[model samples]
Target: MTLELIDIAVQDSQSHPRLAGRVTGHVRAVLSEMLDGREQTHELSIPVWADIADGTSQSDIDLALMLKAAKIVARLKLSLQSPP
Candidate 1:
């Protein structure tokens, strides 16, 4: 489904530590796959959207993906820099 139709509803934690931990782990797993590594220290705030069948459209999703790749490349460059 298009991101426009995929409503990301934030659910409240019911004060259940176990459930919260599981959710967090799952989210990390998915993001980790996207980041090309098991660990990622970078922080990115991207609001993404995609075109739907409607007359209007949003290209945020593509922007977000591009940003993510750029972040990884930037961090890799920094890692390769010599000590000042």
Candidate 2:
């Protein structure tokens, strides 16, 4: 899907802002060890719409949705680090 669509999905989560907080928390937890000392940067790319063809399975569709949500959360975190 296009970045605009992904952005829209992220915006939708604003209605439940706590979801963003939870996602950020989980991310921090996962990286806590690596973040303990010194500063580091990492790059990630999540394909929200991959292997989605005419007859994609329901499970695959669900996974794509989850990936899209993850992408949204990552975007939210990055935005937080930006200069305001």
Candidate 3:
């Protein structure tokens, strides 16, 4: 399976560029791991937006993004099995 990440946009009030980069990195890793070895022939474009509030911990952000990535992968798998 081929996976391409077009873009990741993060919005926060604190304007933490470093934190945003970390979040996107974590997200990309999670998505890559989840989509690895999948039998996806066509392209699937999934746009995910995450909002990080002030005072949120890094672990919490990572967990939430991982869950979101899992959900996206699960939904895609289901859709691929359905008839057109």
- TM-score for candidate 3, please give it: 0.43
Query: Where does candidate 3 have its weakest 10-residue lDDT segment?
Result: 6-15
Give TM per candidate: 0.32, 0.36, 0.43
Steric clashes per prediction: 1, 0, 0
**lDDT at 23, model 1:** 16
Better of 1 and 3 by TM-score: 3
lDDT of 3 by residue, 27-64 (tens): 34223322456643333333444567767786667556
RMSD each, Å:
14.4, 12.7, 8.6
Give lDDT tens digits, candidate 2, residues 1-84.
111222222111111243321221111111111334554444333333333455655555555555665666557566655375
Query: Cα lDDT for residue 27, model 2?
Result: 15
Q: Which RMSD does model 2 reach against the true structure?
A: 12.7
- What would the per-residue lDDT of candidate 1 be over residues 51-70, giving only the tens digit for each residue? 22333222433333344444
Candidate 2: stretches off by over 4 Å: 1-51, 82-84
Q: For candidate 2, what is the TM-score?
A: 0.36
- Number of the candidate with higher lDDT, 1 or 3: 3
Off by over 4 Å in 3: 1-48, 82-84
What root-mean-square deviation over C-alphas does model 1 reach? 14.4
Every candidate's lDDT:
0.31, 0.37, 0.48
| Clash pairs, model 1 backbone | 49-61
Any runs in candidate 1 off by more than 4 Å, and if so which? 1-58
